[model samples]
Target: MLSGCVLAGWLVSGLPALAAFKLCNQSYDVLNIAIAQPGPEQAAADDFVTRGWWRVAPNQCATLVREPLKTRFLYVFATDVFGKEALSGAIPLCVGTRRFVIERQGDCLLRGFLDARFLEVDTTDQSDWTVFVSPRPS
Candidate 1:
């Protein structure tokens, strides 16, 4: 079960304004980015932007909107914080007008393979992601 597919590495190469940006699963896999954050919406309200790059179907794969968190997920090497981005982009946090408070828990990394069998997911597999969340500036 853990040795069938290779967890595709997603490279978010797009406009940086998309703070809460989501990447397309290159290998057409759907996995939960179990965000170890606060509660809900804080991440989106602060630095979350959605990036739509699903090449299969509009309803295929998972997007930020579908993420357990209400923001976009970016892939990093280890630990890297997102700084102030000064670009003009409109990556809506919600599809309509449901403003969600992004969840911010660990100001470090999000480790743990989401259970696929128990959770109905897009990338229904065991994939681990590293979320580099930095401290909010005072």
Candidate 2:
């Protein structure tokens, strides 16, 4: 379980905002994060492509999607070094024990992957967004 972790999102400020999806870790320990987005053929396949295992250290940030935002929503899941869930949500997605890029969701166990709940982030169609992960209030 997450021992007091909070995830928040916002846009970065600059002459021209960086067009990318980023996550900043303010938690107390290292974290492994995953991201899920609509598949290239989402309209026809109605599926999502999930990628993961970005090792983020405390007080640092990682650029998950290094391009202009194309989707209004993105899903995220993260865990601490000990495999304890640090951030999650209602969206169930598929993940793997090692680095992976799962092409679809559901039947995780049968598909040789693990089922994980991901927090859905609404970017409000912003071109650039940053998610800050920090310790929850005591």
Candidate 3:
């Protein structure tokens, strides 16, 4: 039989690492953050859902998704504290000026909303992922 200490060590080593999705702000100015991930009810009728508005202060970090990541892809959008665009990408995603959860991406103006470029992050199906938001270089 294995000793108590040996058994404990083995068990600990066999356990999986903590899984989470986190955002880190590495800029001087405060940032307004948003995220989009897979949504429930993926029936033929209902489709993917995306939500946002997680504010992150300068030199801070926020946990966007506390549980283990369920999707391989994630979308992100962020702006400065002054409502000026800070970071964006070519991928277009439906977003609002205020806190919102869009069911799908399309026709922002018709839906009474604005369009924002959401950067896509590929997590490679990892259980944990962290995204760092940095200011544009002068």
Query: Which candidate number maximizes lDDT?
Result: 2
Model 3 lDDT per residue over 48-135, tens place: 4657777888779888888888888877777777877666666676777788888866677888877877777888887788777665
Say which candidate scores most in TM-score: 2
Indicate whether candidate 1 or candidate 3 has the larger TM-score.
3
All-Cα superposition RMSD per candidate: 16.7, 2.0, 11.6
- Per-residue lDDT of 18-131 in model 1, one digit per residue for the tens? 223233323222322322222345444334322222222212333343333332333211111121121112221211112222322222123221111111122222232212
TM-score of 1: 0.21
Worst 10 residues of 2 by lDDT: 1-10
Q: In model 3, where do residues sit more than 4 Å from their true spots?
A: 1-17, 40-47
TM-score of each: 0.21, 0.90, 0.77
Whole-model lDDT values for every prediction: 0.25, 0.86, 0.69
Estimate, for each residue in 1-138, the C-alpha lDDT of model 2 and write its tens digit: 245355556654567767899999987789999999998888744389999999999899999999998999998999999999998998888999999999967789998999999898999998888888887666
Better of 1 and 2 by lDDT: 2
Ranking the candidates on lDDT from highest down gives 2, 3, 1
